[model samples]
Target: EAAVTQSPRNKVAVTGGKVTLSCNQTNNHNNMYWYRQDTGHGLRLIHYSYGAGSTEKGDIPDGYKASRPSQENFSLILELATPSQTSVYFCASGETWGVYAEQFFGPGTRLTVL
Candidate 1:
């Protein structure tokens, strides 16, 4: 089973400050993703990686950057935090990209930018 974990379950940042959210997985899966969930919108993908050393921008990568230094770790970086970026972020991992493949989610990190 894929197990994903995220740090700093809650965060508060000032506008223009930098923020880094970390995620780690123990499933040895090939795919990892970062997504943010807002009140009325579906989970929008920000970035994803096929494996370590590779990162791919997803549907909404505008204000975020992603890093995958190793198969077990991934991080999301916000260069300049803004109130608009405040949202619940989730990290997920899956063995495959097919619709049938279940993606495991970590306890979300709620971020608030003032």
Candidate 2:
């Protein structure tokens, strides 16, 4: 089975509060990522992992932390969130970064920070 899933599909956070979004992939892919979608910026990467216990900062890593406890699990944490962080977040699992690599995405998570 191939699937990517995200928890707390919808979230409302208060400014300066803590927020954590979780993701799981059953695809057993070697790559996982966290991204935020905004109107003008399109989709911006926040954090990613190559595999268990391996995390890398993405295009926009500020204000975010990522954890990869195992091959199937990845999480994004915002210790002090802000309204500017409000956006639709997505988690994806992929085999690699190339034309032949296939990626599966979790149903988007809507996060609104007030």
- Candidate that scores best on lDDT: 1
Every candidate's lDDT = 0.94, 0.94
* Clash count per candidate: 0, 0
Model 1 scores a TM of 0.94
Once fitted onto the true fold, the runs of candidate 1 whose alpha carbons sit more than 4 angstroms away are: 97-100
Per-residue CA lDDT of candidate 2, range 1-114, in tens? 688999999999999999999999998898999999999888899999999999999999999999999999999999999999999999999977677487789998999999
Error of 2 at 62 (Å): 0.6
Off by over 4 Å in 2: 97-100
Q: Please, what are the lDDT tens digits per residue for candidate 1 over residues 1-114?
A: 557899999999999999999999998888899999998998999999999999999999998999999999999999999999999999998877567478889999999999
Residue pairs in clash, model 1: none
